[model samples]
Target: MWRTPLEQTATAALFLGIIMSQIVGEGSAVKVLSQPGQQVTLLCSYNYEDNTHIPQLSVQWRGPNNQLLCHYIKHKAYQNCTRGYTISYSPSSITLTIQHVHMEDFGAHVCSVSKPHEFSDYSMELARMSEYVTSAPKSGGDQSGSTWTLIIFHTLLSVCM
Candidate 1:
């Protein structure tokens, strides 16, 4: 059986559309800190074919020791936060506030957004601890104690997940 040229062209166009849709479907990137402790907002944006339902957005702050300090899930009024950290969000952004800034707060933080069937994620890092604070005190000791709390919290997240 011989197929018409128009049919072949339509089939080729459909295949190309499907491939392009998958490539540009959903993705996100965490913005670098324009400045530390200045109410930094991490943005997680995604593209979907349909927008009939409200999407779920999750944001987390990780400490220097790869620990989860704060987390927020959409629709939940309460947050899971570490002792010195707070979590909040808007429609398209999640913000983590670190009070009385300390060295342990320096590390990679991740922001993730998800819908019923699709999701996106991103990561950012604070290169130096001193960047968060202008003046440095002349004191040195094991800072691990302060960060230990975050580590424990991260463990709980792992178990729950």
Candidate 2:
């Protein structure tokens, strides 16, 4: 059978489209949070065309030197969290909670999901706050609480201006 120019072009385009879809992988934005003592949770969500089969999720927390501090795999019940780190995962998202925030914990955390042949990964930095302020002083040690109250009042007044 002889194929016309238009027919040949259309067939090539369709074939390319199918190949592109399989080659391209899906990825989601990485989000980071910080807390005082509790572990900080990093959330990542992704979507793909093929969702019939469940995907395997993996999360890794790396130090500034690119050392793997923690890693979690879906099927493996065991996790290799750092001395002070913990990792967990759900079907579509992965979470890494650092037991106690350390200087080395302030680095990139990577989250990845994979199927039989496709996978995607993303990374984000976790930062630590140098100084933290307390709500109030216990037992009314001094006029600090009153000073804070005045500060809040002025802040709110300025915002309303």
Candidate 3:
């Protein structure tokens, strides 16, 4: 059976659409690092030729274990922040702020964005803390507390040494 010219053109256009989506779906990548107990922020950005055509930007954050830590949908944040996290976004940028970093928060993190019919993403790999911060000695600390303090002090000193 012979296909009409209009039908043939439509089929070709559809095929091209799929190929373009795959090409543009893969976004960029970035890496970030911070010390434990400190705050950190991850950023994401997107550009469009037609500003008005810009699609809604969806942001997702995944932890080292591929766990879903947080997400932004329709300008709202749904976060499972273990120690308090926040999401901020605009037409061109999306920012994820994580507070009170811990050892468990180390390692790879993924950020994804979904827009209209296209998608983009990036990844951030957190490095191990090189040192730890010491807090003021507690009033009337027990003997065990002092011992733990000494141990931690030596550890930090050794690293510096």
45-133 in candidate 1: lDDT tens per residue?
A: 33332444454555565665768877776656547988867776655455665654455555566655555665666555543322222
Instruction: Order the candidate numbers by lDDT, best to worst.
Output: 3, 2, 1
lDDT of 2 at 51: 59
State each model's C-alpha RMSD to the native: 20.9, 21.5, 22.5
List, residue by residue over 60-153, the lDDT tens digit for candidate 2.
6565578877777655665787677666665555556566666666666665555556677766556543233345545656666546744553
* TM-score of predicted structure 1: 0.46
Task: Give the clashing pairs for model 3.
Answer: none
lDDT by candidate, in order shown:
0.47, 0.51, 0.57
Candidate 3: 10-residue stretch with minimal lDDT: 9-18
**Taking the tens digit of each residue's C-alpha lDDT, what string does model 3 give over 5-40?**
333332333233233334444353333445666666
Q: What is the lDDT of residue 121 in candidate 3?
A: 65
- What's model 3's lDDT at 63? 83
- lDDT for residue 67 in candidate 3, whole number 0-100: 82
> Which prediction has more favorable TM-score, 1 or 2?
2
TM-score of each candidate structure, all chains considered together: 0.46, 0.51, 0.55
lDDT of 1: 0.47
Q: Residue-pair clashes per candidate, as listed?
A: 0, 0, 0
Q: Is candidate 2 or candidate 3 better by TM-score?
A: 3
Colliding pairs, model 2: none
State the local distance difference test value for candidate 3: 0.57
